[model samples]
Target: MNSVRNPVLRSFCGWLTALLVVASVAFASGEVRAASFQPLEIVTQSGVQVFSVEIATTEEEKTTGLMYRKELPDGKGMLFDFSPEQQVSMWMKNTYISLDMIFIRADGRILRIAENTEPLSTRIIPSGGLAKGVLEVSAGTAQKYGIRPGDRVAHPLFNGH
Candidate 1:
């Protein structure tokens, strides 16, 4: 009975170890997690443009924003929340796709727009004024949607909504 029980315990331990190893590999490869997306809208002169944006609220999420992604569909984006409306800086390190970074004020007004940012660049993109959030979308998105400075953004994070 003791010998049989020992073999069964060892087999269970081995299976658990294998499962942990696979999980570790998937996490290290950055393929095990899916981003959480939220609805956002921009009211421009043309009309209201909607987007499904992933909110990056935590330090870790902000640090890893869109890194290693191969593509970003049109009307999809990531929103980085830096509350209290302070000047923020961003870079494209490890980012595979170019983006248009929209700096939004605390009142949900667009402060500035950095369009056609180079991918994988380490150059610092600065918000010219105080901003509470930064929205990153595919390159050329702003031009296609007629997004401009002073446009209103409606989301739960800002006062516009």
Candidate 2:
């Protein structure tokens, strides 16, 4: 009988297994982490920073927007770039995580923040004004990060100043 008791190898194996599980789950769940991640930054008038999110550029991707996920890690979010500023409405219909939807104008200025939306609710969440995008983050993110209408969001989809 051979006993393999190398702690380093055991640790590596455990880590590998965890990675594999996460990858499989993510893959099976349709790559919600993102097909290709992009950096999205939000800066307040007084230099306060809020979010750094991934951009969701396609209709299919935006439609999927964080549905069926058991957890949403901290400091992470999805940006649905709906281009050409228009009225926007969202729902938590198939979504499993409570979210704060931050709507932005064509120029990337925050227009509204729909906070603490109930998970799996069919309620319509609307942007009070024409918006070019919606940033979806874990519930409480808006309050926690001091994000508010008028703040600036930086991304390629916006007319950054």
Candidate 3:
């Protein structure tokens, strides 16, 4: 029986080790790029919280609003944008969790808040009046923090749409 070490195999192992080290360093330094979003964190007058929200500004995105998501992170929410402000209606057609939708004007002022919307219900949740943006957070979050019409949504994304 003959035992021999392959140089090619040794080189391959060294290259793999180097690649893994680079990847590890990138991850440790938070330099690893995410292929998808990490959920948005929003703060209202109530406090800081995290939530997973889908942004719906365009006709298409709004059509698919939070259809299949099952979990919602606390303090995180979605900002739906609309160009040329008008009344918007949202429904929990495919949504699996209850949400509180906060309607905001173009200036980021809260116009109306629909809280504790039933999940998977087709009930029409209207924005009441013209609004430029809508934020969806966990159920009852709006009332818990005293978020009401006229309160401003202080986020940089609220420029116009």
Question: Tens-digit lDDT track for model 3 on 1-161?
Answer: 75337988878888999999998876455343213233443456676545555555566566656666666766666677775678888899878789999887777678898989999999999989988778888898877776777766665446531
Give residue 63's lDDT in candidate 2 (0 to 100).
82
Predicted structure 3: clash tally: 7
- Cand. 3 Cα-lDDT: 0.71
In angstroms, the error of model 1 at 57 is 0.4
If scored against the real structure, what TM-score would every candidate get? 0.84, 0.77, 0.65
- Among all candidates shown, the one with the greatest lDDT: 1
Cα RMSD (angstroms) for every candidate in the order listed: 3.9, 7.8, 9.1
Q: For residues 59-97, write the lDDT of model 1, one tens digit per residue.
A: 878898888777889999999999878999999998889
Candidate 3: stretches off by over 4 Å: 1-54, 157-161
TM-score of 1: 0.84
Sort the predicted structures by TM-score, highest score first: 1, 2, 3
**Least accurate stretch of 10 residues (summed lDDT) in model 3?**
30-39
The lowest-lDDT stretch of 10 consecutive residues in candidate 1 is: 26-35
Separate clash counts for every candidate: 0, 0, 7
Off by over 4 Å in 1: 1-35
If candidate 2 were superposed on the true structure by all CA atoms, what would the RMSD be? 7.8
